[model samples]
Each structure stands twice: as structure tokens, then as C-alpha cells.
Target: MGPSRPERARREAVAKVRDQILASLLSGRYRPGEKAPSVRRMAALTGRSRRSVHEAYRQLAAEGLLEVRWGSGTFFAETHPLALAPETSAPPPALPAIPLELRRLAERLELGEAGLARLVAYWAGYARDHVELAVVECNGEQRGLMARELGETLGVRCREIDLAELGPAGARLRRVSAIVTSCCHRDEVAPFAEAAGRPLFTVSMDPGFLPPLLDALARGPLVMIVRDRAYGPVLSRFLETLRLPPEQIARLAVVEPDGLIGALAERDRPGALYVSPLVRDRVGRLDLDGWRELEPRRFVARDEVDHLWAHLAWLRARAQP
Candidate 1:
């Protein structure tokens, strides 16, 4: 027998939720291995019921477009069948002055149209060959991870440097086309970036972590694991902006990598776990079979990356004659 009208309506509702989430995944609104918004939050955001949202998540999970990590909440699958192709994707924004600049430079050098064409090709190749970015972080672990992420995303070489060592690394920094660091460290990294005359970019925390983190704090104790002690306080300060009560904030603990095992061992029940990307592999090695793990770590927002790309393109466009 076929479904009744009401039943069909319910099915359509579920499909709508599924399709919306799927579109976001395909659009890179959420990146691979990135956590999705919580079911409650998603339901509220989409004006759908929790049941519909749950069913939508289930459908995606079954298809492997999303992963349901038991206690870790849901995440976009790292590999999926629906990868977008380059040709089908929209191209990055192009600077309008590129051709004009090329023409002007060619005229200045007394190069004809054919020579201008060659000059354009040469400049394009030079930009591609020399593109390098520096990622500065307060600690070694984060520096490496951020550098790797930026390198992979932008298809450029990345030099990872610690903030503490930035002054001594001026010569190395000068060779990089730009410097990037977390927004929290902008002030700390600015002087060095200015000294080296390299453009500075800042990455913000991914919004995906907020729902899960807030839920965890409301439920029970929560511990955030970090690779460096100094980083913990910076993270705690960011959390304060969430407007959580002092008591609720107290329930949240930030622990260094070495203290994670102990923190987990002593955590209260119904609590959740959050670990930095720098220490995620190590956390995976522990006995977290039944722990409710929440997503931690930050991502370079798409706008931030796009802005950086545009800046680099403009630099290439303004090539000296």
C-alpha cells in the first residue's frame, strides 16, 4: 500500500531537511571532517521538528555523506561520492585591473602584443611557482596543523613558525608572500608581519563548535584539551563571550595534552570531551569508548580564505614593469 497524504507530507518534510543539509555539505559550508550543527540547533535553524532533523541525519549517515560518531556528534564524512569538480565550480574572483596593468607594463617596456602575451604567461607562472605563506602560532603543534591546512587549501608552500620565535625568523618571513595566524594572536603577530612587510591574515574559530560546546556545558562537566598551557587561557577567554554563567564556565575545564587522560578519568558523568586538532590523534589512542566527544579546533572561514586569495591575486596583478 502507498503512503497516505499526511504520511507523504511527513516524508517530504524529512527529504527537505536532508536536501538542505546535503546542499550545505556540497557547497563547502561545512568542510570534510567538520562537525555539523547539533540536531536541536539544526531543527531550530531550519524551522523543522527534531524528529525530522534526526531522520535527515540518519539518511545522510546511511549514505556515508555524513558520519555519526556515537558519542562525538555527527560530522561531514571525510570522503564522499559527491565531490565537486573544478570545472563545475565557480572561479575565484578576478581583479579587474590585471589586463590593464599587463598592457601598461608591456607598453612601458616597449613590448608588442605578442610580447605582452609572453609577459602575462611568465608572470602567471612566476606567481604559481613562488607562492608561499607563513603560519604563525603560539605553539609548535598548532603552527604545524594550521600550516598544513593553509598549504592544502591554497595549494601553496607554508612556513610554520612559533610566535615566540617570530623576531628571529625575520629573514625567513621576508621570503613568504604572507603571514597568517589565529585572530587571537593578531596583535601579537602584527609587529613581526609589519617588520617583514608581509600581509597578515587571521583565522577565526569555526561556528560548528558552539552548539556542541554549549550543550556540553549545560549537561555536565566538560574538558578542553590543548597542546600548550598558554593556549588554554586564550581559549577560556573566547568561551567567556558565550555569556555562560561563572558556575557553568567552572564546569568547563581546559587541560594540557599531558593531563587529558587524567581529566577524562576523573570527569563527571553525562559530560562531554573536546580536544584540539593538534592533539586529536593522541586523544583517539585513549580509552574513550563511551565518552561523549564534542568537536574542537578552528577553521579558516571561507571569506577569510577568499580574501587572502584575492589579495595574492592582486599582488600578482600589480607586477612591476
Candidate 2:
């Protein structure tokens, strides 16, 4: 009745490889007609065998998403394929038109007529007044900041919870209509949201803010002061993806809070110092003043918070009776 261990492992391998490649493309890694990372490079990054990577590439090519050359390399197709694209406007939500047999079964289960109506009313009312967006992140300050921003923009109550506190089997998760997370914590938070049957969305970055930052990075390497948590590692990978060499950019992590300034007392410092905005307030407590904000480029690029608010509003309205 169930798949064997080998079968399940193979399925997971394909899915993981597929998702990583898609994530790279969506993040604007390569230009149009530019070669994608070689199968060997991808294998190294994903920690998979080259044979598996090659198989995944072949599958994508068959799907019309990638083109492979004999000696050149694999590249993305100029046109993107969006299967059954999400419409700007969704169809009005209506209760399912159940067949007679299913309706009979519902009646037998005491879910007929008034009971069904009560269930509908409860979910609709819950969406109306009890919808709370919980942002699960490991960094407390960043979590609080995101909660504040979303609450202000969406006009809905929001809360922040640590990833450790959010489990798949919690009543707290059931109360949430949606889970909001940064791109970095997405994979970590996805399983919990899935178990709770709620949709999880990653907020995008401000595009206007990034070009100038990238311009700054292009000028020269900078030393980045990072927290020991998720933001540090995630930001590091993001910068490396943009082709900033590790040696050129000095990264400070695993240092205690407010200890960064002291740690830099005699160590090598770059021409510029970049700090995650999450720790900006902490850094301000010190006398130091020459640091630039390291924007994580969270990869969801649309800037206006109100746009996500509007989408949430749409989701709310669509849940009506």
C-alpha cells in the first residue's frame, strides 16, 4: 500500500533538485540565454550526486524549461512556463456542489444542512475577526519588526513566534489563517504550515533599496557583522550568489551581542561595514557609526507591503458565505 524506502528516497531527490533549480531561476541568478550552473556545480551545492543532477536536468529539459547542448551547457528556455497560472482575479468561492451520495454520507455523519451551515459560518466568521498572521523566525528582533510592519500594512493583528515554538501539532497553528515567513525560514516553516492546512507566504524585498546596495558591493568588498542565527548564514549565501568572494568579504558571526565592536578592536576590517538591519538597533548602542545595512535580498522582490495586504484582503473576502 505504501512506497518502499528506495522509492520514497528517489521521489524526494527529484523534488529537491527540481525546487533548487527553480529557486535559482526565480531569484534572477542567470541572464536570458546565459548558461545555468553546470550539473557538477549544482550537485556540489545541493550535496547530491552528479548522476542525480544530470537526471533532473534531463527531466526539466523534457518539460521545455531547459535546453541542453552537446558541448556548451544547459540554459533556461527564453520563455517561462507557468502551468495553469494564478489569475489576477480568482473565481468567487462557493460551497462545493456535492453529489447526492456524498450528501447522504454527510447527513449520516451529522454534517448535513444546519450542521454544514454552522461549519461554514464558523470558518467565515473566524476569517473575519480571528485571523492572525504569525511570522515564525529565529531572530526575535527581526521577528518583532516584521510583525510590526505587517500589522501596520495589513490592518490585521499579527504576532511573531520563534521557529522552535511552532510545531506541526499545535493548537496555536490551527488558529492561524496563514503563516508569514522570510525566504530563509521557508523550508523550515513549510511543514508546520502544511500540517495545519494554512498557506505560507514569504514577503518580498524592496527593489529600489537593492540596486544601490548591489552597486555598493560592486565597488568593493565589505565586512559584514552578522547574528549567529538564520539571517547571518542566509545573507552570506545570498551575497556569495551575487559572486562576492568569501575571502574578499570578511564576515563576523558567532560573536556575542555588542561584542562585535570589541572584536573589531584589532582585527582586519573592510573599507565598509555592512550590518543586518535586525541588529542595527543593538549596533547603535555602541559608539560605532560607519555601517551600511545589508539587505538580504529575500528574493520575493515586490516592495509595497500593501500589495500583500491587498492579497490577504482578497483571501478574506473570498472566504465569505
Candidate 3:
């Protein structure tokens, strides 16, 4: 009457892979008629198996979202049904690129061409220094991705540190010029920053997190797996800002990483399973059968990054010899 466990697992793996590609498509990362990455490339990128990725691509082809060529790689459909309509109240365009902003500031300071070049070089060197900024997160994968994205956005080489490992990072922690983290993690991270005597800045959680949140609620009861007890309250506070109804809130459960496998076993039909950044690695290691591990993409918000840029500029001004 029901699908076998392995069959269900295959379906779930395919669905999760499909969602990843769909997100990239919706975000305009892959434009119409653009060549999509090959199965091998995608498997490597997502750290998923080749079979899962191939199944996902085949499913998308059936849905008219992708075109697969025998010799050539897969390509995004020229006219897909999932075309996103422009938003009427879309947010304002981001502030000019960081380099452009720096150039403008140089002009305002009345620097000549040579002086401007020197200023640019100085800032570039400082930003590219690996010890300049430390990015903290509970999950290793999320931490690395977040740090890499922020570093690219700000032209900085960030030091990635796990929240749990902060205690052991004595000299490395002290060497960094500043520390940054998701606003949702500020509480847990603040104590570390305070102890290290380092200034802390928080970037707002990316809006991309909303899609997965809504999808999880619509599915049924939801269970969130987090790394430690500290994240429970912190995540709760962040969720409050979203204004979820009390009924929907009641449908959610926050469990520690250790409890995840046991919790799943207890439920005959588990609803949407969400993993916080801290526990992502743990979830990946578990044999979830068909259960999908939904985690939001780690992205740096432009406005927050601009605020970070301002702070870095001020520090540079004060540090001038």
C-alpha cells in the first residue's frame, strides 16, 4: 500500500535536489536559455550524490523547467512556466558597489588621482587581510559559506570560526579586527565577543529564509533541529519578528541535534524538518531515509553589508598614520 523505505528515500533526495536548483532558477542565477551546470558539477557543488542530481534534472525536464541534451549539458528552459513576475513594491536598488563607494569617498576627501590610488590600495590590502574579520556560525558548512559570501561582497578575507569552537580560538580570536554574525545569533555570539574584547556587528537574516519558512508551515507540523540550547531562545526571538500566528507557532518543535534521530523515529509521518545552521553537519550525517533537511541559503544582505562598509571606513580613517 505504501512505498518502500528506500524508494521514499530516493524520492526525497530527488525533491531536495530539485528545490536547490529551483531556488537558483528563481533567483535569476540561471537565466532563460542559459546552460545549467552538468550533473557532475552540480553533485560536486551541493555535495549530493550524482544519482540524486540526475534524478532531479530528469524531473525538471519533465516539468518543462530544463532541457537536457545527450551530448551537451543541461540548459534552463527558454520559456519556463515558473517565470517570476516583477514585484510591484520591490525594495530599492542596493547602494552602489563597494569599490564605487570608496571612489566617491576619495573624491569627497579631495584626494588627487595618485592619492586616490594609494587610498584604494591601502583599503584593498586591509580588506583582503585574512585576520581582518571573523565570521561565526554553529554549523561548519553554513559558517564557511556565510564567511565566503560576506568576504566576496566586502572584498574582505574573513576568518571562519564555529560558535562552539570560539572558546579554543584564543590567539586567532584576538588577532581579528572585528567579529560578525547573523542577527539571529547575536545573543550566543555576544558573550564571546565581550569576552574577547572584540567589537561585534550583526547582519540581518537574508529574506531568502522566508520561502523555506512558509513552505515548512504549509507542509504540516514542523520540527527544527538546532545545535544547542542557546539557539532555542535566539531563534524564537527572531521568529517573533516574522509575526507567525500562535497556532502555527504551536505546530513547531525545537530539538537539539542529539534528539533529531530519536524524534524522527517517534513520528510515523514527520512533517517538515528544518535544520538550523549549527546542526546542519549533524543532520547531514544522519540516515533520514526520505526526510528532507531544509536550511535557508546563507547570504549577505546588501544594506547590512553597506553598514559594515561604513564601519570599516571609519576605522581606516582613525588608523591612518
Give candidates' CA RMSD values in order: 24.8, 21.9, 22.5
Clashing pairs in 3: none
Residue-level lDDT for 104 in candidate 1: 62
Per-model CA lDDT versus the true structure: 0.66, 0.56, 0.65
Best first by lDDT, ranked: 1, 3, 2
Give the count of colliding residue pairs in each prediction.
0, 0, 0
Off by over 4 Å in 3: 1-125, 134-175, 179-200, 255-257, 275-282, 285-295, 310-321
Clashing residue pairs for model 1? none
Score residue 231 of candidate 3 by CA lDDT. 48
Assess every candidate by TM-score. 0.54, 0.46, 0.44
What is residue 87's positional error in candidate 2, in angstroms?
38
- Best-to-worst ranking by TM-score: 1, 2, 3
Q: What is the lDDT of residue 108 in candidate 2?
A: 52
Q: Least lDDT summed over 10 consecutive residues: which range in candidate 1?
A: 312-321
Better of 2 and 3 by TM-score: 2
- Candidate 2, TM-score vs. the true structure? 0.46
Q: Which candidate ranks first by TM-score, i.e. highest?
A: 1
Per-residue lDDT of 264 in model 2: 57
TM-score, structure 3 vs. true: 0.44
lDDT (tens digit, per residue) of candidate 2 on 24-51: 5433454446677888898998888787
lDDT tens string, model 3, 16-59? 67767764654456677889888899999877889989977876
